[model samples]
Target: MAKHHYKVGQTVSGITKGYTSEGLGILYTEDNSRFFVKGLIDGEEAEAKITYVGQRSSYAKLTKLITKSDKRIQPKCPVSTACGGCQFQHIAYDEQLKIKRGIVENAFRTIAKSDHPVDECVASPMPYYYRNKMQIPLGLDKKGNIISGFYRARTHIIIPTPECVIENERSNGIIATIRALMKSMRIPPYDEDKRSGVIRHILIRTSYYTPGLMVVLITNADNFYSRNNFVKALTKAHPEITTVVQNVNKRKTSVILGKRFRTLYGPGFIEDDILGIRFKISPQSFFQINPLQTENLYKIAIEKAEINNSHTVLDAYCGIGTISLIAARHAKKVIGVEINSRAIRDARSNANRNNIDNVEFYTADASDFMENEAKLGSKYDVVIMDPPRKGSDEKFLNAVLTLEPKKVVYVSCNPGTLARDITLLNKKYEIKSITPVDMFSQTYHVETVVLIERK
Candidate 1:
């Protein structure tokens, strides 16, 4: 091992060379040592204090600004710098789009080893107040005051962010109401250290195309105290609140949601419309956070798929059958598969609610289902896979290859994993086109959709 040139807490000045995919600015000094920083832009000169140094790189906290990039702007939210929910809130929106495109291009070039021409990122219409859902943690301050906010960047410590610029305005009111109820009702917040208290977290979901709100109270116990009065008061405070569900999380882990659930009022779910199709959203189901951009993202994805009346589309990870129902209108038949039975239940109800019979949904592991489809000699003309942040596995990719769909439409959130999976699928499929959509505004995360065809 060798001694490093800089020590922790020592401030060093450097010009930013570029940005990492996680929206951290890469700075280089005269010694060629690299440091990753946040809230700094390209060609910006700044002095940053070293926080942690590793073998090849280090992370720093911005201390002083020497030269500011024109791309920088005044952040809308006061706690934007501390909240882990958003990055790039301090940068210009146009420049943020450029950086996201660069991120997608860099991932494909460096990881996939392809010089594919990446398209410009599709900007969201409402960059601010675009988020339809918010999951905030609850705790008590030192004075035993109820606090509701998000976690600090890379840490579990909550930072009070009541007026998040990206979330719906009603979310703030809902949170404020809950906090008041916690204080008045004498409900103590869950203490992670001592594993005591009651309310753990709260998830509020709002819809744009529809008129409904869903409030999911994540609790530390199954039996809520004064359950009827609590529900009545909450709904009365916010008349828009259509459904309220309780999820008990007694586990000693960091994960927020638990397996047990019980609906206290209403249908326990809310319906949102996308692309002329209605979807029933559950408490824990996976759905796009931004409604307007989700519409654009799905439109771009479907346009790239280019399905016809003769085509059969297979939607993997088809939560609530959003894409499946939309594609069913254009394709002859669409089959959706997902592992979450609850999401499958909502997906089926959505299909029936819309009276669309051309689509069928199955609750099964995508990899296992596709592999068994291979064994059964079932075929599909087009396969649309919208996997999680980890992307698809080799087993799923191999199964996709075995199925030999004429076209593969991959929708991904992580560029690195998307590029890696595309590299493997490239052996059997040729990349047709790639498009990036700004699903998450003021964040480093970008949603990319790739269209591939059999070589």
Candidate 2:
């Protein structure tokens, strides 16, 4: 990192760009070469400071937007840009969908064009308050006061938020209660720089199946407070909270979950119902943030899978068996593979609760499972994958190709990685159609469903 030379009020010309990870950063110039910014968008002139000067590209921070984009809107949340939870809150909701659509199309044209051209991007029906889970980080200000909020983008520094627009009113109320508790207890907030703290983060999950909420406290010290007092306070304050647990995370890392967790109150899990399917989700389980949009996404994925009584489907990265249970109704057998044993257990429990006997879940890496299954001469008619934002690995893509499934319904959050994998699979599959679903409203992130048929 070099001394930021680009001062405020300095006008610099740059191009607007859209990348997979780094949101719309500005493409500036220095020494007659191009330098890109990380926290900027297109068509906006900003008084920015060059944070880093690298061999290829430089990073800059926006100080002032001299000329803003027409799509820019008054961010609903007070801590919009600072909060890492969302990326496109400053842009208009309608424009956010449009930009996400462009992101999906660009990925197809650039990475998966050899297969078949993408037709249109599907826009999400609802944009706000779609999130079902929210993790709030606990931090301290300069005065050593507790500040429970979200981290700033690309930084561990906590941006204290009075209210979050993405979270539900119930979830937000939990946040408020936690804040009040911290103030009442007068506990020292976590200090990232000094590495001395108590509470690190708070995890909350809610569903319609349960009357109470699930609360997990992540902390370093073991003797922070009496477990009885903590649980008693929480139970009295919020009786709807049927579950509460304390997660011990001593390591100085950014990840939420740690190695050990202890139940402080009620059961160790919460139940979430989806399309008549019931699932048990723990603190570590991976579920979709937006439940309503997820219904739409799953509907599209199941439809594309083309389930029948005779068909066998494979659901890869099937967290809590959300798709497996749904597909089980139509398919003779649905096999779901996941890396997390916790999620696998949840999926199995979900299947049993839903009375879907046709689905089987395994706690193994999907790519490895598929490879071994292929060697054993097993095959599936339809394969559905919902990978992380980085997309599927090369090995997974190759396994799917080798198996030669009749159809593949690929759901992706990151368009670039999805495009790259789709390009590899294009050798044996024809790109049938692409639909972009706007799950996170007021955010640049888009969920895309790509339908591919055997060539």
Candidate 3:
């Protein structure tokens, strides 16, 4: 390997040209080499010290802002720089929308090689305090005291946070109560290195449209000493809590939840309303974290679907029938497929609870289900897919091409993968419109809804 052009601890100043995929501002040095700097906005001249020198690009920490951009603002959170939770907190909200739109447009142009237009990102109604769910890791601070907060960027070290601005406000009190209970009860935070200790993580979920909250205590062992007392204390302190669950995970893994769950209070689940439809969210269910933005995203997807009483819809990777049930109200029939059995069970129960008979759910891989459906000559007038951040694979795209749905609606979290998948499907479908939604306001993540029609 050759020596890097930029040396560690060296300071340089340049104008920020643009943002990288990870939301870091990109600056070009005099030698035309790139440096990725944190806490910067486009069109700003900044001085930064090189932290890490890589083969292609160097990483830097912003030392001083010589010329600040108009989009810069004072971050609300005190630990925004070190928390690594929100990347665009320093940038204005309106400018964040434009940056996200540019991200999507660049992905389409560079990855998909398509000149399709991407509209401005739809702003969230409530940017701060909009998150309905939080999974906080429990660990010991420097003094060996129990602490609860999110992990620092690219490290296991926990950044003690008594409050997070993006998460639901009610969660702060709940977490504080749980942390105090654990400390009083002498419950040790799980040590990943030793694979020992008691409490691992605390998962909290709240409802925006209903008065209910669910707490799941993830532990290293099934036995939680005086678990009943803990539950009672939580419920007494927070009357809004409707359910409490204890999940066990003995294996030394990074995954949060375990296979077995023991309900300590209520129905082991909490109910929430989305677009007037009730959904039972359990400890393991994959529901949207932001309810306000979810409603907006679903409305756009449903509108782009153009569902009618005469249409049949296929919802791929449908988690808990959130989208399928919503579409059933406007479509004749809807079939939802998911790989997780727990999600499928919740989906079935939700459909029945909503008294929706036009929708059915199956537990299977989305691509496999679509492939088998194509072989069976089953046709769907509309197809709706909300895939994971990795987006759809080639097999799924091939199956979609075979089905030849009149209209396809794609809900994507990662624009890069979305562009790649769209390119694969472009062989049979033509892009109509792409609308970006601000699902995660402060973070670099953005949700996009795209509509495509058969060519």
Report RMSD for candidate 3.
1.6
Tens-digit per-residue lDDT, 224-319, candidate 3: 688788789889989889989999989878888889999989989888988999999999898999898899999999999999999999999999
TM-scores for every predicted model = 0.98, 0.90, 0.97
Worst 10-residue lDDT window, candidate 1: 1-10
Candidate 3 regions exceeding 4 Å error are 1-4
Q: How many backbone clashes does candidate 1 have?
A: 0
Task: Give the TM-score comparing model 3 with the true structure, all chains together.
Answer: 0.97
Q: What's the lDDT for candidate 3?
A: 0.91
Report the C-alpha lDDT of model 2 over 282-328, residue by residue, as the tens digit.
88888887777778888888887778999999999998899888888
Per-residue error for 338 in candidate 1, Å, reads 0.6
* RMSD to truth, every model: 1.4, 3.3, 1.6
